[model samples]
Target: MKERIRWMALHGFISGVSKLGARRGDPQARLIADPWVRENPGAFADECRKRGSLIRCRAAFLTFDHGVAHEVLRSDDFSVLEQGSNLPRPLRWIAKKTDPGLLHPLRPPSLLSVEPPAHTRYRKLVSSVFTPRAVAALRERVEQTAASLLDDLDGHDAAVVDIVDKYCSRLPVTVIGDILGVPDEDRPRILHFGELGAPSLDIGVSWQQYQQVQAAIAGFNGWLAGHLRELRGAPGEDLMSQIIRASEEGPRLNEEELQALAGLVLAAGFETTVNLLGNGIRMLLDAPEHLETLAARPELWPNAVEEILRLESPVQMTARAAVKDVDVAGMRVQKGETVIIHLAGANRDPNVFPDPHRFDIERDNAGKHLSFSGGRHFCLGAALARAEGEVGLRTFFERFPHARLAGSGSRRDTRVLRGWSSLPITLDARDAAMSSSG
Candidate 1:
């Protein structure tokens, strides 16, 4: 029965992708929400497990003018996909030349774009900044930021407040700004860049939006350039200063690379974290009983955050390209084909996560979720993202134990970023105090 259902789901997904378009945000959502797909949580996984390697599903969504349509593929068989041939063209261009405008190099970098030597060099260069110890050092600062944000929400009596705008979105932006040494006044401007960069998939760039993004990119680069100049003359104790100093080497990031790195950090640091927070808050609120359970046992906050990420990963999927003609599952994938890895679907795989739909905070495998992804492209800021989420959830429950979703919240239209545009939440100060007191 289960096998039959899985087959039906795969067929439905293929049909939907064929009819609506592979990357269509609305259609993809509909496909994901399909009864067949939901019922066969392990459909793709089972296929991969059975094939003993990557399995390709026959589905072609229309690609952007620059992109090529190909079959959807998955593999639990290989630890990492082979590199060189898999490099997507846009990323290939950036890897070959330094382009600052590619702010959020969410795709592979030249260093990370290929295998071995180059990947090693790029990883070595940026690894120090994102080291676990470095991220851990920011713990107290992260906590303070969470506390400060909660404090600001203290007296608000409105029936509902958009947590996405009010709390979830702001915390990471502020934290990333602090890390990059972005000036106090310029934080909002940098966040504007994040807004423009946060779309689900790259809609072939709109000229107006492109200009706005470019201007913001330029503004940030100019700021970093001045900072780099200052740091060159007199060193400081921050990530920017470190990057500036590292550039003294011959292969250092050029002006464009520097800006791209800075912008990537700023955009990703805030955007992903915001989604994590927003999704976490919405999940907790949807299950008030669980929220109450969490309020009673503060120790469970970390695990709760993990479960939230598991159930509601902020990033739904990311695209990769085939380097050469390869077979996945039973189908042949040609070179230059684009493959969309569905993180959201993978996270909910029933074989891996039992009763996957239930938001079980006490689930034993909570920490193992792929919300931060896996392999070479694992989120560099995973540690920082975790710390921010842990602190954010802890502080929110401590401050507003009775907080509840007051109205319907809207999800961002972008499929890649699966989060609330506005999460209306209400807090009862008196209830919070009573809960704490008891």
Candidate 2:
């Protein structure tokens, strides 16, 4: 009920503002101008397909067709926008005023927001560090972290606990924090900033939510600036120190760029992993058979993570503006036009995956989903995310095999990201040994 009311209020606010400036007779203007489109993207896509796969909405085109979505994502003629502000004009103006630092034009663009050359440079800088070997090196640490987290939760004798809050949220933050040399005490703050800024990833966000994003950006950058300063004087054995050393030794990033890169890396590293763990666990709890199967054959945890990513992707959609005129799915998309790829919908397209909606851990081609996206923008931390998901899932069920959903879960009301805000569950320590013995 609370989520519904909030959704309705937000929808009304955005619609009211958009209608005030939107041209009534303009079909193209109604594309993303319809605020409700964000809430029911699959339905909106179905409606758009009446015209064509690349039907224009307001000024941008939305692709729900799987093949077209894939083609658009992989095309080099498209580029990310300079600042894809999700807020309507008035709301964005207010946000800019509330925290000007967050919208600083000089602020370094993160990998998600940066176009090539710069994007290429950032990817090259971090790719080698996340190689298979490097990710494997962290496997034991991720397992230990996950076990320690579940241990903390299992220590509580309460009948119900918010698993999202207690376990899912902390594991990724701790793992990423440890990698980045962020102190134990500061991990919580990093998690808070990540949560606060996450909604900004959506194509549209409310004024209040935009304000929260701006504040989060400011707080995050401020913290990064201080941390970078400390790392400069006395180097450590962490990734940040390695980055600082690289910057000093070679063609380097300025201080602001260095901080921006670190913030981006840390945020990306933790954010998606958190959702993967949360969403994967929720799916298992919803399907008790799958939960039992996973418990009995823990080797399937990797496949389970991939399936969860396909069905309920952490990053739901990404947009790109056409750099040159090109024909997309039989429609000519002109330069400067934006193409929105609905990844979640594409993943469910039956044309690509046979019986796409079913949750099957043994699904043969599950990794084919565009959940991590494609082309030059493919997720750099894919290996790390997968490793974290595998370990997190295995440790969670092993510690509390009998855990069951205890209450209704509340999902985060963000369009770009999908995951629960709170998932209440009950578990008993006694069930662990009993289930293991059986």
Candidate 3:
């Protein structure tokens, strides 16, 4: 009852309001309430872009402009508020008192949910985990993992396979699991936990959704607690063990902070990368010209990954709240107001990329994308994700040059997290398979 009451006060209330506004043809409302609108957000983004760089919506200030989004994300004036922290004092107290003690993705202590000092400390400690040298070292492992996954698909021969379930989802989770010292058996559970808790990253979720995600969070939290205990008892050479040693010996992290950091690193390590692989696969298959170009000029794979991230951003939008009264694009956004930055829109802005809708692997400024986000809270796992995406997609295509999408696959249901849920792919025995099999 407490959970439901608190949820109703926040997520439920926003959901109901958005639905009502959707009926009145509000763009922001439809953007939230209408699934179709979100899946095809370019038109909606264009509408917002036409209005201005920043427009006051019924719920928050919105920005589709790349410059504005970049500024807000990098600016110190914005805060990544703890979930429900903006509510009335009494309600916030209720939220705090009723907390189920799960490590939620969008709540305090999670790197994505806290302001500096805490965020800075967490990022600084974990920063070594994905340094360029570390990513380069892990590249070979990612390549081997990708090759092994692609090899497993050989049994299908001429049959159509759901690559998402069979490969895309497996590669990153497995690799990241190794990095985190999670056992092979536990990786699938981690993936399941990620999938279930993914919608937790979004706002205005339904009451049932809130319940389901909370339950998943509970499962994840319990499993993680045990895993951390196991790691401490028998520390491994993996990064998580390093984090444990550092936290204990360095500026000491509390139990919750440690759990939050571990959970975010593990989840963030694979979730978006999975989306990146899935989206990259679909993009490469759809645009064979780019694929052919990449085949000839394999050096373009990294830039191609950037273009994929820009064209089909794994994360569509992010929000930041004003810590003080600020003037944005001539609009006075008072203190405490939130601003939604359409990352996808920014990637496709005409001012930035010429022929923005077209997928051009040769595009010069492809790396300028805000897909991994920007500013102090920029994605910590970006180097790893980039390595995984480049290696995974390149290896998959090189191994199965004859691969094609067998059918139109289903996309992930959440608006914030974007990717194919079921990508039916068919691959014939390509020439590259002969040497490996021989």
Candidate 4:
């Protein structure tokens, strides 16, 4: 009952407010509360942009304009809004009372929710392991993993396979598991936790889903505690072990902090990349012209990956709160106010890209898309995700040149993390198997 009440005070209450606002025709509310918006947000995003660069909704202000979104994301005047900060006093009290004490990825100490000084300390310790050189060194391993996953798909008697299950989801989790020193046997459980907890990043989840998310967090926290203890006793070459040692040498991370950081890494490391690969696979199959372009000019693979990010950002939107009164897009946003930065809309802003909806693998400025966000809070796994996207997609298509969508694929029932839950696909030219057998 306490957990139910707590869930109601936080996710439930906010979701109710947003749903009411959506019914009354608020663009930002519709964007958050409407499930259809998750699947087809372009229209709502356009409506928000049409209203103004910075506009108010019933609960908070929002922006889909690229420039405004960029400013809010990169500016020091704004910071990530702590969970329940925007809630009314009574609800906040209720939420505090029922706090689960689990190391939630959206709560403090996790890079996603914390502010500077602590965020700085935690990120500094964790960033060393994900440096460009470190990520680059893993590229060969990523390629090999991709090949192995494809080999598994090939060995299957049936030509049709769900890319999300068999390929897109497997590559990143396997690679990230290896990077984090998780035992091979434990990867599947982590993946399950990830799928359940993903909705925790979004607003307007059902009470049932919130319950499931909490349960997943509980499971992950328990598992991570044991894993971290093992690392502390005898560290390995993995990123988690390195982080453990680095913290001991400098500003030490407590058990809670270590869980927050490592949990975030383990979850964020693969979750977004899973979406990137799944989205990239669906997009490439839809646009064979670009695939042909990629095949002909293999060197464009990196930029092609960027284009995929721009066109279908894995993370659709994020929020930042004003630290002080600030002027944006010729309007004043007072302190304590929050603004949602619609990254998906910003990526499609016509001001930035010519015919933004059109997917062009050769887009020169595609890297400028705020898909990974910017400034002090830039995605810690950007390099790794890009490497995964480029390697995963390129290797899949290279292996099965005639791969095609077998049927209409189903998108995940998630608002924040956009990707397919099931992407049915047919691998290879139809007669290739017969010819090989002969």
Q: What is the lDDT of residue 96 in candidate 1?
A: 41
List candidate 3 segments past 4 Å from native: 87-94, 429-438
Judging by TM-score, tell me the better candidate of 2 and 4.
4
* Model 4, global lDDT: 0.87
Instruction: Judge candidate 3 against the unseen true structure and give its global Cα lDDT, from 0 to 1.
Output: 0.85
For model 1, residues 1-438, the per-residue Cα lDDT tens digits are: 432333223233334443454344333333343434332433533433343234344432211111011123223222233222333455444334433433334434433233445555555667866677778877778888888888888866554678888899889988887778766787777676677656513332334544554565556557667765666688677776677677656458676556556656776678888888988888777787887888788788888888988777777655556566765545566766645555666676666678877899999988866667565657777888989998988788778877877788887645456777788887874664566699
- Report the lDDT of model 3 for residue 295: 92
Q: Of models 2 and 3, which has the larger TM-score? A: 3
Q: Give each model's whole-structure lDDT.
A: 0.62, 0.74, 0.85, 0.87
How would you encode candidate 3's per-residue C-alpha lDDT over 292-363 as one tens digit per residue? Answer: 898999999999999999988999988889999988878888899889888999998989989888899989
Q: Order the numbered candidates by lDDT, best leading.
A: 4, 3, 2, 1
Q: What does candidate 2's lDDT look like per residue over 1-438, in tens digits?
A: 433343334343554545654556332334336546545554554565566666666556777678888887788898766552533566545544544444332234667777778877777777645667767777778888888888788688666799888898898888788778888888889989988988756533666775687678788878888888888988787777877787677657788677777887787787788788888888888898998788687878888888889888888878888888998887888888788787887877777778777899888888888889898889878888988888888788887877878778887877778788889887763564466688
Q: What TM-score fits each model?
A: 0.74, 0.86, 0.95, 0.97
* Worst-scoring 10-residue span by lDDT in model 3: 427-436
Query: Runs in model 4 with CA error above 4 Å?
Result: 432-438
Candidate 4 has a TM-score of 0.97
Q: Sort all candidates by TM-score, best to worst.
A: 4, 3, 2, 1
Error of 1 at 73 (Å): 11
Encode model 4's per-residue lDDT on 22-103: one tens digit a residue.
8998877787788778878766677667788888887688888999988888899999977787778999899888887888
Question: Highest lDDT: which candidate?
Answer: 4
